[model samples]
Target: MTRQLRTGFLLALQFFSVIPVKKQLPMEKEYITAMYAILPLLGLLFGSVLTSTVWLLRDTTEISSLLLGFIVVLIGLVLTGGLHMDGLADTGDAYFSYQDRDKRLAIMGDPRIGAFGAMALVVAIVGKIILVAESINEASLVWVLLIPVFSRIGLLALFSFTKSAKPDGVAAFFQKRVSHKKLQLVAIVALVISFMLLIWSATFLSAIVLIILLFGFSWLYRAWCLRNFSGVTGDLLGAYVEGVEILLWMSLLFFV
Candidate 1:
């Protein structure tokens, strides 16, 4: 059990970072569960950094809102190594490849960025910065951390429900091993914990809105994939996760 917990933690870290675990950690049913559990913990760490940065900037200089926003965004992208940025790029390439599903997926697999991909990356990053800068709320910044974590879980949901379109990739392994029951449990636990930890009001209104939006987006994406591709691929899953995160942030920013 101890070994499994360590392996799961490693897996979660690897999933979010460029660092690779050398050995094949034996997969247990709890591996995905652990990933879901550790997600908010990671979010908390990143949130702390951003929140600190924001407060420091607000205190340190009378920077214009536009400049401060840009700086905050720059710091965030640097911290994450622009992980979602890559996802946005890949997604744009795939979506605009002007080819068949296979060809589109192949485009996404390429390391090179196309014009469409570049535009998507610019829009997502800039849009996020603008929204965060304008809001200037500490709680809102903290909630932004959940964007990446929950979005990744949304990707994991796609993996659980669909098959890989190719023979090898990150999604391949997860798709092969992650089960429906495990994914469902992970989703339930993650959502519950998110609300429990994020509670700022007695009404729990914000949490309820977030829950509805997250599940609604997940189910809608699943249905769209079924109608179009018949199965989800690594690239498509990446796109879904990033897209969902962007929309989720937008919703939270405006609604909550």
Candidate 2:
């Protein structure tokens, strides 16, 4: 059990981020399920890196908040290797194509980027930088740490509740291996932990509102994916992570 859990963490790190994991890990059912279960922890790791970066920049340098925000955003792109951003681009391209479901999926599978994809990437990146710049201050560093954590919690919820759009691909393969009950339990525990952190750093009311918004957006996004793609795909899941992070950051502008 310990070995599976450890390998699962490594697997999640390897597949989701730019972290180096040289040893090839087993991709068995238990390990893959464990990988999905550990996703929020992965988000926590990312949050820590981001929080640390903010601290280092603010404490050690005289950089402006706007530049600090841009650096933080750049670090995120570096950390994930823009994996989710690619998904966001693909999703934007496919959705705006105004094609049928099959055609949209085909566009997503293509390696080439379209004008819509480029536009989506620009808006998302610029929006994230501006929002982070506006939202972060000395009192609200906790919000920075919690934003990715909640966005990932949203990811788990979306994956648990939605069906894969196709019979093949990374999303479908992992979806088959996951135990929805176990994944839900993981998400619940992560949510509880996140709430505790939020309450410690901010108001209980704020915590409640953030969670509500997270899940509500996830529900709505699930419906949107269903309407457009018939179900979730790997690309759509990536799009959710990017979309939800932006939403969480934007929400902090209100409460934090």
- Top lDDT: which candidate number? 2
lDDT of 2 by residue, 83-142 (tens): 999999999999999999999999999999999999999999999999888776643778
Q: Residue 117 of model 2: what lDDT? A: 97
Query: Clashing residue pairs in candidate 1, if any?
Result: none
Query: Could you list the CA RMSD of all candidates, in the order they appear?
Result: 3.2, 1.1
TM-score of 1: 0.80
Error of 2 at 135 (Å): 0.9
What are the lDDT scores of the predictions, listed in order? 0.67, 0.88
Local lDDT at 44 for model 1:
55
